[model samples]
Target chain A: MKKLINLQPSKPVRVLLGLLPFIILLLLYIGASDARLADNPNDKLLPSLNSFVEAIDRMAFTADKRSGGYLFWQDSYSSLKRLFTGVGISAALALSLGVLMGAIPFFRAKLSPLVTAISLIPPMAILPILFIIFGLGEFSKVVLIVIGIAPFITRDVLQRVQEIPSEQIIKAQTLGANTWQIILRVILPQIMPRLLAAVRLSLGAAWLFLIAAEAIAATDGLGYRIFLVRRYLSMDVILPYVAWITLLAFIIDYLIRLASAKLYPWFHSQEN
Target chain B: MSYLNIQNLWKEYGDQIVLEQINNKVEKGDFVTIVGASGCGKTTFLKMLLGTETPSRGQILLDGQPIASEPNEERGIVFQRYSVFPHMTVLENVMLSRELESSPILGRLFGKQKKQAAEDAKQMIELVGLSHALNKYPHELSGGMQQRLALAQSLIKKPRILLLDEPFGALDPGIRTDMHQLVLKLWKEHQLTIFMITHDIKEGFFLGTRLWVFDKDRFDPQAPNAYGAKITYDLPVGDIDKETYQQIDQSLTPSEPEIAEAS
Candidate 1:
């Protein structure tokens, strides 16, 4: 018999091992909820699985009394819109600034220090200032998310661009490429996959900033709904909303990874 | 006038001199292979020829005119690594050289121009014997295949001078021999003037029409940077005998005192 350290699991065993934790957690939650509910029949802390299902149905299937739209979908749509817009703007800004700073010494000297300084400042610290200036609206929420992630994404992009071997740039020049030509043809295509990767890494931080802003001031959003229901100790709604957010984040992250693998096969292969 | 001329060329970084009092002249079809110990400024010399590095003093003249301080289409280079763009497939990599030349602003060719560029690139790829792997990325290629792709990438530009810096140093011996035949064929067929730097003395002798040894005539143990390397010996390749080859090999084989003093 092999020692424990030397033992290797087969494919099916590995899959079972991965699922074990989630299954255990689910059973524990169900057992705890049953005990709590049997004791008082009005336990808000660990609502029964049935309560969670009913809460989800009410939020998702039923139309809101005040608003004509379904509350759950409306919140998700608004939150996703802000998230994508903020991240999209951040990605575009980072790519352009990064390529310039990385490739050209002039831009690097002038802007690199400033970018570094900006990245060092805590983005959350400026949330109040953003709300004050841009006001308590969709714009401020978007700006907060942008401020939270853009500098980080920009720095990643700049480092990646700098990481491009100088030989490739010189070879491009020998092919009669001028400055613009080299950036467009040689540098830009290579930096793109890196940009996608940077964006994916920043998505967690992006969502954090977006939700925090929404909770603070938005009329309708996933974060807004969760925070609003907390007044009455509405764990049923809050728990379901948290799960939905986690699922959304996971799906987005998975899609980005899949897209990167398909679109930039060379980049992934090089990583291996 | 010679096709290329170097008149008392010097390169220095700060107070440290890398190459000093280098002078050479080459005809259009000369294949000059440079061999030197490490840190002897062989690569700096090649970069100077490629126009990516400017001489700190003096000038390099091409066709009786001063060479551009920046790299241009007249010269092409292949490094030991990062010679080909990793993002592009082999076909796209070769096509890009022509595309950049044809369309300056967008760095892209379209319709008839694109089709013509692809056709030319395919021919060049075939010349390098990479026709089967046209759509493969650089990461998919073996070292020798990558070098072949690099060759195709550079050759498509029709450079008058091809600069190679230890292009086969990392390849297996069997692959290196295959690459040698491919390169010689390309050199003859294209009628290109080539400057290749290699650490291997035998490779220099085997590949070049002329072999150059870069070594410092003077060395300062105290300052170390007081004197720089120069073209100590320039021999026509076929005229050299076996004894001379052994002497050159021993001199460049990294003796402790020489390596320490040079660095």
Candidate 2:
């Protein structure tokens, strides 16, 4: 029975399986929302229907700006780039500090309590201080995020490093490994799984902070656009941006997990 | 002078004494096994030999010189479950020890000597009957196989003394016997001096050319009287037969709490 469950889906089977959800959801939404359809159905649907088909046609052919859909695409692309860069910078800073704190015992002991204290202070509490310090710029937003995300990363990784079996370190030492060798070969491999998990968790926190940071402190990001739409009560625009963020987060998390499984096949087998 | 000698060795933990007046000698290529019930300080004896722990009373001399304060390349140790690096392949683990001992800065950067050490590691793996598992991680291998890899890594450095702390306690009886034979074969071929600690009487009797038993006061017959006391046995192993081993097992009464036996 376990063996049967482990069998990989064929290409066509996987494709069909992937499409099955969208198909089901599409049918459900159409069926469920159809009852509330407006009496002037043509008036409500005709322009959007025509615009959707035209947008698809334009996308299929060229970069022609027919009906200002080009503006939406451009804004989304720039927003995506900004979001990913923001996430990457914060994650990188967090991971570096995390690994550094995790590997050094004295640093871990001395710094961890301060980190815990800082992490408990609400992220929302930091905006005014950040604005006062960095004066309402990108620096304030990025710095706010780095401060918010790095402690969780450090705490998770420090705990993980401590949890690695002491036997592994002793084994390497008996084999004549130096401190650096032990870290690179033995400690790093053991912590990679924990590190990956920490990153996956922090990615969500970082995203939350990013939107909050952008919405309050700056402009020209998805968070700002969402906040702007909310002001006008533009639920459609707001909902779509939320959907995009959710989809992107899901994709990034999935990709990282896939990479982890590939790099550490031993973990996946144990997971079963 | 003996190849390895301890001079009036004494070990104590604060007010409690662990080992008192331990004086022993091991010749070149000798297989010495220490056997005792739990908490007999057999492990402490090995730790002193490895220089991992200190004896408060005396000094250890290897090759007629005092052993240093830290562990060195001359003593290779095999732990119970953690002898091999779990993440690295068998080949990588074996080669890494050699690289640590020999590689220079430029050689390490270029990985030149490491490459050569890898080939040598492959040869050692073949010697240990694990060539097929050269690329497998420790977790992917069986317990017996992992122990075999541990042996390979220990031997790869060609250390003068091989210290084992009940390395086969986790293996089944049959696999344990196989590992014993494999270890003896490698030891004989390399003329390696072995100091192993085990609680298994059969294993102690079977492997050691000379067996020393630790009779701690806790496990000894008379607790209050035998407190801070010990008895050592030097059982000669020469042309021993199965019946003789059985006789040795049957003749002795172990120290039970209420029943005190004289040494």
Candidate 3:
């Protein structure tokens, strides 16, 4: 432990070290793409940088000749809307239900086992059921994301709420708080950033559910586009789409982190 | 009948009685400090006063009426730890009850009332000597400062009874002494009925208008639950004379109070 502690360098150098892996991956990918293109100019497996750039330009800059709509922006907007909506509904349900389970005995007894059971069931297993019930449309996709991720978020929020000292609740009670007041006044604000964190953790599952739902059945979405072009083995479009999704996810995650740190710094430090 | 009365209060878990045949009355503005050996149910007694726990037998009456079953604004509590909310600033912690009790939706009072609550909370923070720290979080404050914030939060509620469990036990000796003086001042200024449980004998005696030593009456080797602790000694500090001390010394123990001031 002492050796590990002593090995730490200053912040800037450490941050640079953290980026080395990404740089190495990029260099390796460029070399592989260059070698594959040299062997065959029309290789779909590892398309050249020119292919990627042309793919981006066509999807982003030029409107599809038939659809006459910018596919990249349209797909981005639809996917982002679904992601936030699913995560938003999940966060709301998780916060309310989690606090109820954590702070109240009746709720804890009633919902704890049920939530645990629901979370244990594979979300993908229920995907067909959701499509059948909600139909193969946007609602089904959003519901899939919620069902896939809400339980985990709910469980995480419940655990965090339980970690709060009982004394804090009792203090609120002594301050004229009834059950609702205790939930709203005492528990809600304290758990806000923590719920954000729970959402952040559930993001991976959220994205998985979203992509699966979209890939299987959707009219217009990033996941749908990737799957749509798979028949032709369009690695160019697929790779760029995957990179775009990664960039969007990274941006959203970074924003949530920044908001949590700025708005509720106490919860941020409490994380450590 | 006094402002607060515990009449024949007995508390027990299935087979073991913690307190039995307890009778005490606390008057308004009384700073009552209780001392007892560990596991003697001193904290339980204070909890009963807060209505967080109820006795198996008998009842606690406030102003001739039985106290409510659940905790309310009438009674406030401060534990040594977790007394202050970690999320709120000191002033916000003090203002929370005011804000919460006002409106359910926004927790906001209209123009003047909001200003009024802010002003009152500010004054309360100053009263606890935390004016410099109204904007700081609980973790940023020292142990003593956190306690001061806790005290301020409770005092802002203007509770009829203040229950403290080892409030100063975590503070340094110097801070503890300062806290002692602050408590006395608050008690006088607010006319609060304070019931404090302390492990330290000296602190119990030094800060209280009335001091109670709690321990069991009869300890049976085989059947300990048969009897539980009562108020072995209830002394009104600063009132007992030399003769009373000699009388207490002559007795087998101070448990037999020669005199007790009626609450």
Candidate 4:
């Protein structure tokens, strides 16, 4: 008897398998929206596919009269700038501080408890304080993302550094690495990929914090626009904004994953 | 002063005596292997010699100077596993010492020093038969290749002493034999002082110019730290053939120490 399917699918089939769920989701949403619009000509809850396409076209293609800029591109740029700035700061801080904490006993003893406590605190809880101290501007928003993600990244980097086999450090010392040298040359390279993984994990929280900050106080941003249209029950605008955010997050995540694999081919194989 | 001298060496952790009254001398170019049962403290002793641990009661002098309290470039070590830096390619692993030395800030040395480092690493890799694997990471290499990488990484530093803790314990019999020959050749060619610990008696006897048997002379559960593992036998193995190893084995007994005064 001939088999209906091979045990493992080929590349094209594998890609189709991955895309199937998203296609089905689009179909289901479209069907629901079609039914709702059929019931009510002005229904905004589940907007018609035409409404979403029209909204996207207006936001993406049309220029705002006041600023003469595409609102979508403006929102995207502001959001990404804040997001990358915050994540980049957090990652850099984590790499330097975490290596010291993990490698030096004095630093570990002094900082580990503080890191644990900070990681435990809900970053959202400090939003009010951040606004009070840093002001309700770009500074506050970026700091919110940094506050929300830095401690976790630090802890992750610390753990990865600590997890490096003591043998490697000892070997490096025997090869003439001083304290700083061991931290920089031996421990840092080992923890770098893990640092990338930490940054990727923290991206979700970074977005959450960025959006929360923008929603509360901002003239322009993806989150501000979503919140701005919500009062008018403009699901057309809000849904697309949410989808755009998701698409952006997915693209960044995928890019980071690809970069990690390229930069650290050994890390993936070492796990197996 | 001897090439390496240990006087009244003792190690204790919270009244748990690990090594007690360990005294020995090793000359330059000596290939000494210490053999013992599990939990016999040979590894601990090796760590002390590597300066990872400070002795409770005595000092180790190398070339008439006290060994540093922390590991330094004077000593190199290869453990049973986890010795190779998995993050580095073969060339980078071997070049790390010179690279770190030349460029302390960047973790890389550039231009002429970089070229020199590469040349030195390439030579060492070729010596270890890993020239074909210069670009390969540690995980991509086989067990023997990884161990060879570790050796190359260590030897590039040109350390005064090389320590091995069951380095061949994980290899197959054939590979282990080849590694033995390789170590011997490296020792002879480099004139290295080698101190290896092993569980296999045959291996210990076969590879060592001198051998130390570590065990407790007296046992007391009630007062455990009162006595601990010591060098029970230190014998000069003039030859490492089957007949010689068998003769030494036959003459061994429970109560009597065999050639305790070799050093």
Candidate 5:
């Protein structure tokens, strides 16, 4: 036999490469199942298949009026919208607090004990406290996210501010930059990439927290829906919802990475 | 009176003495370069002058007045690294000092108020041959270009004296030569007093109107005020076009036996 050539797919040719494995698996699966289908003694399979197709077709056609309840994927959109609101608020509050703490050493020092205490206890531990304070509403969810995310953001920005090259600060002083100029101009730019990285990391944390928050006290989120499926042992619904969550998280993470790469190309160079 | 004088200068880090009983005088518009081996406190001395660091003993008198701590705007300094702000464009870096001088109040208002400052920045950018990249960020430039941007930032301040700490040491040989020539041209054009430190002996000889050979052993790390690793000798490098004078001075310069005793 002639020697076989093993070809590695490159980035540009990845689509074609990806299809190869799928096609092979599909053919093998169909070939193996073909005998089983013919061997089946049930003409009753027609009724079940008809019911499955009918349900799918009805949902596909009437998806608009039902508020997309039948389409699990459409329900995920509402969940996503709610998650976005939670995340946006969390990020803004955390970023503001982070910048404030990072900029003022006195404030950071004064708040050190309290911040340490709060951050040491995971937000999940204080579910009862959040329930008491904000109730089992959106307020509780937002509080859960902010508490989970703020300390990490503050520490990240603080470290970045501290790690800013002293030479740059000294140089700015020599150039006659006042304290404010040094902070706003020289120090700010240096810390921005790290701060952004912290925000991206916080977003992922917030996403996880949102699910946890919904699980603690909520009726309508992806996590809630997943919980509902588990109670009924409906793995079909659970499986699709799980896949949807995974895909959504992947897209969010990818978008964040893309933003980071665009904003901070120097980070890639630093890795090497 | 000397334009600036370093009399009985001393510096120490904890128990270690880096500079001790050093005396030197510089005239207005003179280009002075100090060269030494590594860890010889060349940068330490420059920092002391810039008031970034304090001398353990002794005083520096500028224009016959003793300098107290750091002056607001009398001296400009450039460093080996491109200390230009990566966020700001080249023009902004050069105009910073002028902005400080002209708009003491405008800065409070966050107003960009220096028409003359902008003009001066443009001229300095052109002087550095960076007219085309005036609006570019420091990170956009090559290392040499960034250093030139840094140089422009320093010179535009128009301080009575310029202090450079091995500003061109980071450049390649060809770019170093170019920078050396550029420094000469800028010195001549501006008639600015320049004091610089460098490890390159030839570079010292090329630009320095007067060069100081800092003796190595004199820097006593244990002493409270060490004079930079025991500068074993001092040589008054003669003026340019005086190679024969340098030869004569070299012979007159203390021999090893005398240097050891003095050190």
Candidate 6:
């Protein structure tokens, strides 16, 4: 008899095993939803599958009478725009500042403490101040996301840069590389994959900051729409919106991971 | 003047002395192997020679000029690990020094220069017996192959001085023997001045034209840091008997019962 810990599954069995929990959850949800609808056809607490499809159609397919635009698509566009912009700026800042701080002792001594202190602050605590200063505009929302994640990414990148063996740096010096040359050739390529990884880790926090900012200040966005529909007790609409947001986040995470693995096979190999 | 001169060199970190009162002159093509117990400042001595760690006192002169305070193209080093850039393929690893030197700001070469550098790097890779792995990254190469790649990376620069810090300390015995032959062939072919530090006394004897033993002649029971190591034995390596080898080996081994038991 094989021991449980030592037992291994074949490829098809592994795939089926991965899907087991989701399948169980789906069946359970369908049974509860059917029972609730039988008891009260108008029950919004556990809406039927038909109700979900109807809500999605109303939000996505129907054009708003006031603005002549699809609310779902518009909200998605605004949210994604803010998310990418904030994360992009943060990535750029992390690459430059992090590499400088990690590679040069002078910069490290000067900036590392400041970065550590900044990263320690709760970003949400400063949301009110950001609203006061930037006046609840898109800029403030974007700035909120940047301030939320930039310090963390910068610190992560700094650690990765510091983790690079000193021998590589010394070897570069002996190869006649000046400081600028070393940064460009030796440090930048190595730091880039690490930067991607940092960004991926920070995406969850980035999204949280984005939704919070949008909920507090924005007239249009995924978070705004969800909050707007809350007053009507629109569980059908809210559930789908939440699922859509989760799906989007999953796709973005997947894409970033795929890009990293594709571009830096060497890094992935070292990791394994 | 000697090809290289170390005059009254001393390296200290605060009050703790690492290396003290080191003085020697090395010819252009001399292969000097150094052996010492762990933490006896053998690496510190090598770092000083490579111009990474400056001596607290005295000076080192190469061909009648003081060696630069920082590492330069005139000196190359291969550490036990991380001697090759992980991100680069074998060819790129060997060609990087040339690219950085020629282009300076961009750290890249183009057109005619790029072609010439690739050619030179390929030849160097061939010399190190890594031609088949030209496109392979450091992670993909075996330990011995990676060290070979590291050698190619350093030798591509054609440095005046080559420093090896326990370059084969982590290899299998069979691979180490193969590497020893490769290093000897490269040394003669390049006519290079080399300084190698090893934990293995046998390796020191087999590879070096001259061997240096770093040990302190004085010890204080109250304060261990009161003294530092110096070149206690500098011998020309012509023929060494088994008894002499055993004596040096016994002397270098630490007198700790725990270490002996662990080994």
Q: In order, what is each prediction's RMSD in angstroms?
A: 1.8, 5.2, 5.3, 4.3, 6.2, 2.1
The candidate, 2 or 3, that scores higher on DockQ is 3
Off by over 4 Å in 4: A1-14, B239-263
Candidate 5 or 2, higher DockQ: 2
Candidate 6 lDDT by residue in tens digits, A1-272 = 89999999999999999999999998999999999889988888888888899988988999888999999999999999999999999999888999999999999999999999999999999999999998988999988989999999999989999999999999999998999998999899998889998999999999999989888889999998888888988999899989999999999999999999999999999999
Instruction: Give the candidate number with the greatest TM-score.
Output: 1
| Number of backbone collisions per candidate | 0, 0, 0, 0, 22, 0
In model 3, the clashing pairs are none
Question: lDDT per residue, candidate 3, A159-251, as tens digits?
Answer: 988888988888888887778877776788888998988888889889898988899988889998999999999998999999989998899
TM-score for the A-chain in each candidate structure: 0.97, 0.74, 0.93, 0.93, 0.72, 0.97
Put down candidate 4 lDDT per residue, A142-251, tens digits, no spaces.
Answer: 88888889999998888888888898889888888888788777788788889999999889899999999999988888988899889999998899899889999999
TM-score of model 2 (first chain only): 0.74
- Ranked by lDDT, the better of candidates 1 and 5 is 1
Task: Sort candidate 3 into its docking category.
Answer: medium
True contacts kept of each: 0.93, 0.38, 0.73, 0.80, 0.33, 0.97
Query: Relative to the true structure, how large is the alpha-carbon lDDT of every model?
Result: 0.91, 0.73, 0.86, 0.88, 0.71, 0.92
Interface RMSD of each: 0.8, 2.9, 1.4, 1.1, 3.6, 0.7
Query: Positional deviation of A93 in candidate 3, in angstroms?
Result: 1.7
Write down the lDDT that model 5 would get.
0.71
DockQ for every model, please. Answer: 0.87, 0.40, 0.59, 0.70, 0.33, 0.88
TM-score of each: 0.96, 0.82, 0.92, 0.93, 0.77, 0.96
Give the better candidate number (1 or 4) by DockQ.
1
Model 5 agreement with the true structure over B108-128: per-residue lDDT tens digits: 223355666688789999999
Deviation (Å) of B27 in candidate 1: 0.8
Give the 10-residue window scoring lowest on summed lDDT in candidate 3 chain B: B254-263
